[model samples]
Target chain A: MAVVKEEEFEFHTGQNRPAGVPDAIQFIDVHKTFGSNQVLRGLSMGLPEGKVSMILGPSGTGKSVCIKHIVGLMYPDSGDVVVAGHSIPSLSDDDLFELRKKFGVLFQDGALFGSLNLYDNVAFPLRQHTEKGEDEIAEIVNRRLSEVGLGNANEKMPNELSGGMRKRAGFARSLVLDPEIVLFDEPDSGLDPVRTALLCELIKEVHAENGGTYVVITHDIMSARRVAEYIAVLWRGRIVEAGPSQELFESENEFVRQFLAGESSGPLGME
Target chain B: MNELFALPREWLAATGEIGRFMGTVMGDVWGGRVLHFFGESLRQAGILIVSSTLVIWALMFILGLICGTEGAYFLEANGAPAYAGVFAAWCDLREIIPYAFGYMMAAKVGTGIVAELGAMRISDEIDALEVMGIDSMTFLCATRLLAAWIVLPFLYLAGMGGAFLASYIAVVQQVGFVSSGGYLLIFWEFQNPPDFLFSLIKAMVMATAIVLVGCYYGYNAGGGPVGVGTATAKSMVLNLVLVHLIGMLGTQVFWGNNPNAPIGG
Candidate 1:
């Protein structure tokens, strides 16, 4: 395991938003380690506001860890994570919880409560955070479910849905809160190509309508090409390259080129 | 040698973690969210009863029968056949029932909780709860703990009643060592209110420990399916040891200096 110190990289403190594009989230030289494994080493990047961004990386990279840090499920060992101008590492517990109200995360498996049906799962955050009447909650839940193409599957248990349907349900649940930031971790992990394409289209449509910052973490090159407005390629616990989606697609960086092309022979060895 | 040293260190760390978990649960019990999750916790209690109560009742009943039969044979051979009723009542009510309930609880309820929460942890449902700004500790661990604390006492009382009934049937009706009237008279003669209270306390304490241990292992579970299985197994082992220790401690605290028998004193 290679250890990259925080001093090795120049940190962008987010005081100055990138030119013509406001960053919705920024990681300034964040470092995290799990025992002997250094998962995120001086990692720094930013996701532009009101756009669809994808963190593209290999399987063992810290893509999921990045999502966790953004949500305050995990904290950095060093440096800071700033979400919508608030420093994540400095927020108190109550403040962090308040901060999380601005976020909606969809885990790879949907993370739907096994005991609750689809309707209840989508309505969970609203029920916990707000005092909305059942009638209004029902309206909002139905609309979001319909938006994600899960309108008729309201009564189904998570275990009863197909992999693609589960992902769609998760997407609907994530949107029910009308969050300012929506994060999806590996949204197309187990779906077929056709299903992936449909899900990608649904995500794009959702982003277009909601107009919030949406960050997707995945290794699917096809999905990235289809849905990403911004792309960050992560490797070996660092950002290999990051920029606008078109620019990143045309990146001249050897590692980014090899990873985007899915070529076997490149800086990223088979190991 | 390293394994031996590491074992105790790990145990101490786990004990501290359980203590912290219990503190958080207690804090949540007083928070506004307690009532919010009460119905859900009660639903969990209902599930706990459905899953573990019958097994608890059956196990205690069989043990009661064994105690009665064994006591009768020895007392009759010793030329004091009438004492069989007193022995059965005293032993079953005072010690065996609580211990039996603890064992069955560790085996059934503890492992069940570990499996359920382990599955939740691995599947990211717990993380989803946190991400949604719900206190997963309060919602998941505290609710289960509250449910166990509420329902376990009643379950123990029911199991105790079943044990006494089984003992009566075994000693007086089945074994024919004593008449029904004679057994009932002597049994009530030896039973005391404090003994029942102490036994109930023991059951509740053991139940709390079981819940805390299960939640700790499950909430922190990692790896995958194999990790979940390992967590469940570890919860069972810890619960068994803690149950025995708590049982002994409760017995000493409640009945050690003063054996509060109805007639003997």
Candidate 2:
């Protein structure tokens, strides 16, 4: 990890998963482009091992793209995305898959299967990845469902559930596998402040409960303040500012100041 | 004209397109999903029981009826004792129940497969699965394929029952054949069970092929909702056509021109 006259920070999720746990989801000189537009230009950031690393950026700032590389969903045009212990570029399909089982992710939309009842949706990963008997699956599914405070909602489908419930259900599914890393694409989107606060609390609870790393990608400033142990401020495909919540807030960087202060005119572009 | 390619080089500088397009497919059919928790464990166990028994029993009962009736029908038409019932049971149970309608089930389940996977891709749900360390293909494809394999033959048996029902109706309606007489007559001529068994094997093979192909197209589907729909349609049409072709080919390769071989008429 590079220290560029910024606040050096580290936090733990309590579990020292030594033989199994990883250091960081690392990216080195990563680059990506879409035709004429460059989405990620030399974006390099090591998501901290276990603590929540909230990526704060405006829309279309490649936060989602950054995580996508970590999961090997998209290959960077150049450079590397190494997660856990495997160099993503060097991994075979099977190896990539094995590497991926370490992380859990929550999408912005929740992306629940409409055809599946909530119970089945939560149990989907278990059934797909294991040969456990129904009795065993039911127990785990029930427990996870209850953990999200939706044990009764198991019979309901995604469509039947509210937006908040759906996201929570997605959260439950992510935790089902007990992954080492959990990534949230946008936890605060479409959520009310109270609900968002509850979500933040749940994220903290999840981290505390499971002791796994979490990378939250969000534009919501309040959320960054609420749940983040570390923050990476992305601007123009470059992390223009980053550090502890207070460090970045109290920093002298004009870019960070403009962004934090919500200024319209500054280093941050309107477009 | 070739220098047009050089334009990107000029703009982006020396671009390294790593890993040349090798035609070699990840040919290995590797890995399957294992249930982790109690509910999930139970659900997987149930999929085999529910999907298979329901499909098979329904199909088998339908086939029994078709055979009984059709045998009687042939017997009545020929004025032979229970001969039509015999023929019906022989033909429907041995061939129609296992292969003909098996092809239909393959189509039913294959189309379903396309839609499920297609929807996932279009909705970015698959991307979600990936980031979670969940292998979407293994989970989705394995479960669906398991269901298809489990249920298809059963559905085929159900079709067999329909045939049996038709045969019985046909036989009973015929001018002057005793109901029990037809069954008895056909029973006397029962040659071998392998005929039915072979057809069932063929059905299983066809079902596997249909499912794998459906999963392949569905998993690889890129377009979106429209693409998923297209995939479903394509998977169905292609499955039916391919199953038909395979059936014919299987007939030729496995049972063609052989006397006393349990081949379809």
Candidate 3:
């Protein structure tokens, strides 16, 4: 990590500890602006392959925007996002879509197709991307549903399910394709503490079993403590500090220390 | 000066944007890229058939009855009650039925799509589809356009049959100014197969525009439920304007110079 200017980013030491593994995803000086509001300003970071990494940031700190860039749903204004060695911005539309197959994203709301039940929602990617017959699809869909503890709820529509159930169903759908990189955008959002813990446990269990790169975008400190092996604390579109979760929790930097400690009296304030 | 032209400039910009969007969707369909999602297209076709068919036909039937009654009374007042079928033929086949079909499509299918896709957009369902490696535009919009192309012609033709039947009933049975045989003879004499084909073309054009406009507004909808509502309203307004524009142009292009009536000849 490079030290930024003294006035603008005084607390930003930009200390990014090496993951000791090749990056599965990289944001190279990426900058994104929506109208006059710049969301990501020179955001450069990397997520280690084959690990559960969490992008820990305060609310409205471009955390979810990072996930979009990783999956090619958004393009940066001035920089590149490299995923699995492919430059996302440079790829043609066909190639971009092909590269997206490596990713499975769970949106905040689950975003399950309202028209499809849990069973069909989980089966949707398979039905569109695979030539497998209904029997095979059902087998896979049932297994994924059971893994999410929604086996009995397969026939339920998305609207019929609770928020936690919908998120779990979305998790099942994300994993159905057996993607190489799975991104969860605020998996703990709109859930009780117990359900959030359980969802985090599910993430850990799934990561351990599958052995793929997993990135969870969230501001939940408890979730970060439980699920993230690698942690990136971002603020103002730039990474303040990022490293192994244990190291990040023990950091001496003011902003990282205060944020990871969930303290209010620090350089961070309501702006 | 800039302020003076601002509204028209904004309108031109929006029109250009819509044109580009529609061009992309049209290209996807024409270039057969939409066929990659042919199953989705078929699903949309089925939905159109199930959800919109009856409503459209019912509206056309009602309009047909109005046309028939109006034509019958007008011809009878002119001491040409026997020529009632000629009025009914032109009304039902050349003008009223097509306009009725456009009106119903704008009200029912077009607004329905705007609401459905607008909800999807606001809820991040469209984003989910994109992240899933699916081309959301082709899956969501182009497939719909293809579906409309596939299903609407048949639906329109069937609705036209309903309209024709209603016209016959209103003229021969309800109005009773002309007998069934007299109405049948003049009606058959007035409209040939070409007129039906022309009318079908008009209605099909309106359907295409309505579906495309619905897709544009819905797919780009933002701001949340209120935004979706706004988009639905905007799509309805644009669809109605387009319906009337296409209707007027169709009439002029198809039947302006030659009324295509046996009596006129």
Candidate 4:
């Protein structure tokens, strides 16, 4: 178990990590519109090479949409989303597929293959991306499975696993490619608090162990406080407040105060 | 008062939904074309190769048995020459089975592929696969198209054998004058080698068209499970229609715009 610093996990309300740390991912002036409904309006952020940068926002603020562009699933209407250096839209399909090797994303639900058991499910990306023989694949798969604390549940189907274990399995999949930049699209969603707590612990521990860049999209204030070095509150597609988590947590921004204080009377609507 | 206009609106909505699903279908086809440019679809070709051996042997034995019996039966009953009866049976073999079997294979395998992919689409698995960097088209469509092209000729050979065997068996064993050896003599004498080749060539061309159409519809099927059922129906019907058009066009090329090719006289 590697050490995760207490200061590194402080609460912030906007995107600003350790400066001069060198960005592994840089999004500059990115605009994405789906048939005239503008999802991202000039969005920009940088993920420092070996730290966790959490993207906190309300629903429909284009969290999944943002990650899709990173993987080249959808192209930005304008501006740049450069990953490991190359801009996304300029890359061809084969180039995009090759570039995706650096990414590991845990989708909201653990999207394991229904036909495949847990062992095979975790082994899928390795088989697709690498030409490793079965013995090597088995070794890698078991090591990842144990990392998420599911070493003994190798033969179970996804349906048989609990919500917590499924998410853990999804996390296990993210590490299969040995990705340098891990992107989590709300890892805490729909999980019980106990599970969420364990997951938050795993996220920090994995970061410390691997020393890779992390981008998490979450609004769970507790998990945000637990794991994020810096946090950005994406309200209506603008970073209302962003800085070091500790500084922002102690700051005077109305939205930040209202948000961190967990008040119901703020501008955030039920709609 | 304007509620009556809902009927027309519903119809237009249906049209638009179909239009969008069709756009998705065209997208699959375009992707398939790019991959297929390097060579023929290996899936279709494999199907042609495997079905060729089986259909050939099965149809040949059937042709021999049927022609022998049928020729004898006609010779004894109608007093027509046994050779005439065998030629008539040959006419059926050279034409019917080749076209019908092509259509059947298209119906069975073509509809099955459409349904399979359609279900995957309905279940949201397709979207999931895309996010994972797996190009679903290259994996699914390439295999199907390759199998069809590779296996079509084999089916036609079997069709030929089946038609001849059935005719031979009915002619001799049921009626009696055409001996077993006589049936073989009649088949070789009356059968033109080009006719057999022509049947296979037609099946080969039709198989490619059928498989492509099947994959195109299946990959983009709408309305989930119901959409899959609809797409399968559409692919089968479309395959049948395309086969007719290709069959006619193939006949024209061989027969020079005549209904029948200028051979077997």
Highest lDDT: which candidate? 3
Candidate 2 Cα lDDT to native = 0.69
Cα deviation of B120 in candidate 4 (Å)?
4.3
Candidate 2, A188-231: lDDT as tens digits? 89999999999999898879888888999998888888898877
How well is each residue in A104-174 modelled by candidate 1, as lDDT tens digits? Answer: 89899899889899999999888888889999999999999999888999999999999888889999999
Question: In terms of lDDT, which candidate is stronger, 2 or 3?
Answer: 3
Interface RMSD of each: 0.6, 1.9, 0.6, 2.5
Error of 4 at A46 (Å): 2.3
The regions of model 3 sitting more than 4 angstroms off are A1-6, B259-265
DockQ category of candidate 1: medium
- Which DockQ-derived CAPRI band holds candidate 2? acceptable
True contacts kept of 1: 0.73
Model 4, B80-175: lDDT tens per residue?
654645554554554455456556667666776787678767754455466556666665666566455445555556566666656655665555
Q: How far is candidate 1 from the true structure (C-alpha RMSD, Å)?
A: 3.2
Clash counts for the predictions, in order: 0, 59, 0, 53
What lDDT tens digits, residue by residue, belong to model 2 across residues B16-107?
21111001111212223323223333454365455444554565555556555555555556777545545665566555555545554565
Task: Write the number of the candidate with greater TM-score, choosing between 2 and 3.
Answer: 3
| Quality of model 3 by C-alpha lDDT | 0.91
- In model 3, the clashing pairs are none
**Model 3 lDDT per residue over A1-271, tens place:** 3333547677777888988999999988888888877788788899999999999998999999999888888889888899999999999999988888878899999999999989999999999999999999999999999998998997899999999999999999999889999999999999999999999999999899988999999999999999999999999898898899999999999999899889999998998
Per-residue lDDT for A161-267 in model 4, tens only?
98788889988988988888788888898898988999999999999988788888887888888998866666554455655667667868666777766778766
